[model samples]
Target: MKKVVELRCGSVDYFGIGAINRFEGIMEQYRKRGITRAGIVTGKNSYRLSGAWDVVKPVLDKTTMEYIHFDGITPNPTVDQIDEAVNLLKDIEPQLIIGIGGGSAIDASKVVAVLLKNTGKTARDIYTGRFKPFEALPTVSINLTHGTGSEVDRYAVATIPEEYDKSGAAADCMYPEYAIDDPGLMLSLPGKEVLYTSLDALNHLVEAATTKLSSPYTVMLAKEGISLIHRWLPRALNDPADLEARYWLLYASVLGGIAIDCAVVHITHPLEHTLSAFRPELEHGFGLTILLPSVIRAIYPAAGRTLSEILKPVVPNLKGTPEEAEEAASALKDWIGGLGVTQGLSDVGFSEDDLPELLKYLRKSQGESGSLSLAPLPVTDELIIRIYRESL
Candidate 1:
């Protein structure tokens, strides 16, 4: 028999609510671990919406540790932005880093933490997956948004601006030492932004469950996230101030992130990333919510049997044979389409004129991204173009 090697699982410390006034108490737990100075990273919009500055300021002020603030982090962080943050961090020189806001800020902080230690390496170097795991700066992420799970994952996604392409870096080293989930911050999120992120988390669960690398551990994460999303996402959408609904969605988001570490995203994310890079106005979650149904239809034949076997009880009308499974998967796609995210590319303002170039970029770009290879089927530039055309 061939030997199978099991990867070691790591631990995460989660602090839910009371984080605003009790942050100092949480830090006391980490203080003995040789932590000192800390840096705060957030985006301008999130800082204003969450009132994070007011909440975090007093915590830092009371601590003996020096605080450095970097507000340059942007949504869908780019390689240049990361490099710029690295340069700034060299000047600030903190031992610990706290990322406050959405996944973008947290992801940017993860890049900043690792890049600051490497000094000379570019984001591409890490993207290549060749770097040895190094001890990262002690980091904690305060999550404001309900998706992207940057709090738990070692992955940091950044766009390489010169190429107008996305790249990701993953190493166990980049996982935050602590994560705080506060529902209070989510109360201020715009209704559309909340729905966008909620859909993003839903896609994460669906894709992770269907991905080839899925295992027992990731399956549980994916299932719980999906179930919770189905249960509470609508409540959250209808009542933004419902802290209970927000908590459920937020926890579901973390579950999805943990699923990524175990099973990873396959098709929807890559296609959506391509769309977002090509058109910045299209929101990331909207991209996934739109493209996912199509991608699901494409991959159903290959993966449907396994999915049906797993989802028959949980997903209505999915059971028995491969053909049945395929039908069930298709039905699920229809249900998702009911969510109003299946709008064609044209609906989103994408013209046919953009197809050839975007398809070319996807084909060439797939060579550099591991996520593309994870698709259920072997993908080609022609295949990607066809999908785009169908989406239109």
Candidate 2:
């Protein structure tokens, strides 16, 4: 049996099978500091359903930590939703915040933690980088899913439904004070939840490994994450209760999050944000998986060597040359398709007609901590259209 590992990136991560047990000590230490009031963020059912709340609630109660629970974080968290969360917590003036669930809940918590401190700032202020946050309430991220890496990173994404704007904001103040990543909490996940979240982690490694901003450290992190996901995602899917599989994937996902935190993702994430924002029902990982092949094709001229090397677990023997970009792209497409996510943009309710507005929302958020510019190749409107059309 592998022992739990404690790592400190942006937060102290207690990682392994029984990692949630660390939460008690975390709560006790925080209570010693006299920071007891907490504004908790979570998806409606996930906190309790994932078994994190059972472990956490007792700890909070034991420490006399009064908390106002906001179990309202939704998939692809919206600006309006975050604003509502801020309104709910304004009176409580929580000295600390707890985000339970996957990336969406944690990302929302990061935003709310800052908003509670910079009382006048809204989602708009942070997402657009119109104003930067210098301080935020300390945060504790109890990550339930093996994807999104929101537990350890300082980036948070929120969408504006009315404007079709989904923007990511990064700041030093947004890092959580503590994070708990226990695979035991992930056993209750449904099959599709397991599948999509694994793909989300895979895509994180994919984009982080290939982007122009990638470094040896980023590639090393992305490589291990990609290999771990390749090995464990299928096992976990076959047996949802596979604790060992869940453990590795959870570790890989944290590596993905840390890799992207150091460098960042390319066109896929930015465009997926637009797609899911345009069609609110669309899942973020499914959208990213669909765009992966097309985006890989666009980036392979520059990133082919690293991508080919990292993807060898699935792609087998391959010369990491610009010439085999199509082959690499096709292998990834088939691999993701085999896993049951065979949807294109049009299949998910996007059309060329929507492209105009999609690009509009995309351009609006560009150059504000923009990932498009960091892509291996220049991201032109023509190339962007081609990638979308190919994904469709």
Candidate 3:
């Protein structure tokens, strides 16, 4: 019997690898369509490194276009920051928005694009389960990192301070009108960030492939992403100058994002967001690395037979029926451990005391979180606490 599921996403045009340098060339296309003014949303670090500011300055200078820059976005952008970015957008009144940099900057850009229209409610109101922001401006993304496929998804997560929840307000409105994936920008990425973002890509693949909601298309994307990550992550790590490896990783990263768009990520991200939000000292990739093994152990047992088959390609050692797939699932943890991050919470500055607080936060957060809801087994507050304790 053929299973069925509905697949839907906002329109996005993807220009991969070397297309970044052609920003001037593409601006005419958008301009011809009346997108004269654009808001440039980028990370201070990425904008500087990718020469994005320089590339666009010439284009903006030539046209009736104007740009406003908001560089305050951080990894796992918070609700407060999105409000600020949206306020900036309202003042700029851009016809379009160009998001440059990593997932955080891109995610913030998605939020800001929509929040421009909603003067009545705050972005915080939208993020904290208070309201949903369904309207957004056209957004374009120039991706500089290989993780957090925020360029392709309508989803954007922001941590709400008052609610103490890392919820997101998602609508097709948040999806970028176009995503420019130029590996050329990735050439200058810091070694540590490259490593962490690749790890982030790997996490995205694992969660998407293993999620209960994973469909055939999502599985295919996940498998390809995992395979590419497995092959290219180390090469990029070993030869940081290898543009080929970086390019492949970037493609893999997009595949991971596509996988998530189809499958919907599970709770691991929200869980990691909880920790990352509270402890900005801890890197986002490092937090996921620490939490992944425990998360996999919790979810693997409950994943579908189709998921087990999907894993077979990425993790080729498992053979036999779906029931027997559990044996193969154990190998996933080992595979993740090999990816340059093998440490516990304590190793990353977390301790026993953090467990109770993190669990409390997780339990109180909403049900749609990619990590908790997708677990093969039903997750409870106790399970999250136990995982944290074990991770520590």
Candidate 4:
């Protein structure tokens, strides 16, 4: 086995076959640390549907720790909703906050934790570059979905609806105290969810590996994540009951998260953020599906070699040299179509008429000093417009 040593973030992670069974033990650890009250943040139905709530409730009851359930979070959570959660958290004044669900819930929990401690900083203040908190309430992240890697990372993304912006904040304090990733919880996901969420992980890996900041360690992690997603996502989608497939995909998501934490995601994430920010109803993975192929084509000249290497394990029959960017783009487009996600912007209720407004949002989200600057090539308004039109 290949062995390497690198400095990782401080979050304690627990995984494997029956890792989630240790949920109560983790809660107990917090309780022993003098946590008197706790809050559970999650989505409307995912907490119960994924059976995480069933496992967590008894622990709170048995430990006799006062707890509140904040289940109002939605996909691509808005600034207002996060403020609402923060207000509740302030009222409850929980000693600990546990985020259980997909990326949105976890991210919302992170911001809530930060804003709760930094009473002067509002959600709007954080998003608008007005305030940056240096501390946050202790947090534990329980991941129900295998994508987003929000469990172990220090990134929290939120949409500012009034400004038509979706942005991410990163701080050392944003990292969770513990991240619980249990594949067993993933078995309850619908097939489409399996595909979409896995795709999100795959995108994270690709974007992280291709960014200018990628290092040898991060690249290796990204490659492994891509290979696992390519192999296991289809199987998990075909058979939702397949624990092995779910386990591997969850593993891949963890790798993807780590890779992005080290190297960071580039163009694809910002573009997807624009979509979800405008249409809060858009599933992140679906927006990625529509834009990724075109974005690949646009950036192939600068990112060709990395893209080729990343896709090689996915498409074994892939031909052409690494410099032939179009070859890699073509193969990736075909693979995405094979996964049954061929809808364009038109399919997602977007049209040529929406392009001007979309470009405005894109410019705001992908400003020169923002995440878009990390793209392999300089991302411009003209290029973004072209990519959006192509995706349509």
User: lDDT tens string, model 1, 1-392?
Assistant: 24232222342546455555556666666566666677777887787678766767776766666777788887787777777777776776778888888888898888788877777876666654556548678778888888878788777777765565665677788888777777777889988888889889878777776676766666677667777877787788788888899888988888888777777788788777777777766788878877765676566667775455444434656544545634664566676665545567899888789988776666556323577676667767776776677678
Could you tell me how far off, in angstroms, the CA of residue 93 lies in candidate 4 after the best superposition?
1.4
On TM-score, the leading prediction is 2
Residue 307: error of model 1 in Å? 3.4
In model 2, the clashing pairs are none
Clashes of 2: 0
Error of 4 at 350 (Å): 1.1
Q: Rate the local accuracy (lDDT) of all candidates.
A: 0.73, 0.86, 0.73, 0.83
Q: What is the lDDT of residue 382 in candidate 1?
A: 71
lDDT (Cα, tens digit) per residue for candidate 2, span 357-381? 8777788874322799878888998
Whole-model alpha-carbon lDDT for candidate 1:
0.73
The sequence of per-residue lDDT tens digits that candidate 3 reaches over residues 231-310 is 88888888888989988898888877777777777757777878876776567777877777667556655664544565
| Candidate 3 TM-score, C-alpha based | 0.91
lDDT of 4 by residue, 330-359 (tens): 678889899889788888888889888977
lDDT agreement of model 4 with the native: 0.83
